[model samples]
Target: MKLTIFDCDGVLVNSEEIYLAAELEFLESIGAGFERKAYMQSFMGLSPGMWEAKLQTCVEAKTGAPLPRDFYAQIDRISTVRLEADLAEIPFARQGINKIAILRCVASSTPSTRLRWKLQHVGLIDLFDPHIFSGDLVANGKPAPDLFLHAATAMNALPHECVVVEDSVNGVIAGKAAGMRVIGFTAGNHCSADHGESLLRSGADIIVENYDDLAAAIERFARPH
Candidate 1:
């Protein structure tokens, strides 16, 4: 059976905007002056470790100073409160996922602990459960093939038999690099006007705008005529 690898944040949960808002607020308060467009385009799909490193680099380059003490802790506090208040599943995601009969698991840049928490909060944890894999499990994350390849191996599926459902350019690139067919999902609020084009440029085989179309897309790849 084919396997479906789902990306957590933007693809399954509508939490990117919450994270973006909290980060933007914190950065602005710290005088980082990070632009929204620049941050989204450059950092959307990176793992937490990579994001902090890159963000700190950008902050220092802009302000000639490293991030303030407890920067991430503060952002976490803000994001947690906001997420508790606003976190929700992507529209029709649960319904769409239920329609997929093939083996499926979540492969995300989020650390395992938080990934499970978010999925549980949004009622998606039961859908993937122990099969969920995180970037923290590997040495490399999105934009590299490591996490996807690891997930494929763990699921006992070949790279070519796995289909990646992602919502970011980095993820699409990673999936293609892992020799998997990638479906770029753009229904997340974080997606900009050119988001789909960017994913295509990054090597996504198809673009799916909403969960309403996702089941059909996955079926096409999993059981081709």
Candidate 2:
């Protein structure tokens, strides 16, 4: 069966900037130098562990303090508040989701619990069947094929028959590595023209800036090849 795998954060919900802003604020509150652009570019599609490792280095260089185990906990708390307040519905996302003729699911780098809460908050929990797949479920996250492959396996769909909708370079890389076609979503400011081009370089078959365009892309995919 053909399947559509969606990335959660920036695609269905407009929470990427909220999360990033929370991270930046948390780091600055703890006296770590936080550069928004640098942080986004470096950690956009990385797993929590990888993010913590990078944050540790930044903390060491800026505050000269060794990374604290509770750092992520604090960041999580801060992000939770910000997300609850700012999580936005992507325009036409629910409409596009409702129009899908194939099975669909979310595959994200965000933890499953958090992803579920966000999806529920935005009224999209029912759009997916059998729940969502998080990077935490696999040994390797985005930029590796594990997460996407896992999702495809869960749906019993072959990689080539599954199309990934993603917003980050790492996600596109993971989708391609998993032998799936990828569509880059550029609704968020984090993904620019250059970023879209990079996603194409990383193996995205198409790029779109809004759900209407995304829906059209999906329809095109449904057509006989």
**65-180 per-residue lDDT for model 1 (tens digits):** 98888999999999999999999999889999998889999999999888999999999999998999999999998889999999999999999899999998888989999999
Instruction: Flag clash pairs in model 1.
Output: none
Task: Compute the lDDT of residue 102 as modeled in candidate 1.
Answer: 92
How high is each candidate's TM-score? 0.95, 0.88
| Best-matching candidate per lDDT | 1
Q: Which stretches of candidate 2 lie over 4 Å from their true place?
A: 29-35, 61-65, 189-193, 222-225
C-alpha lDDT of all candidate models, in order:
0.91, 0.82
lDDT tens digits, residues 133-177, model 2? 998999988888999999999989999899999888788888889
lDDT of 1: 0.91
TM-score for predicted model 1 compared with the true structure: 0.95
Q: What's the CA error at residue 146 for candidate 2, in Å?
A: 0.7
**Model 2 worst lDDT run, 10 consecutive residues:** 33-42
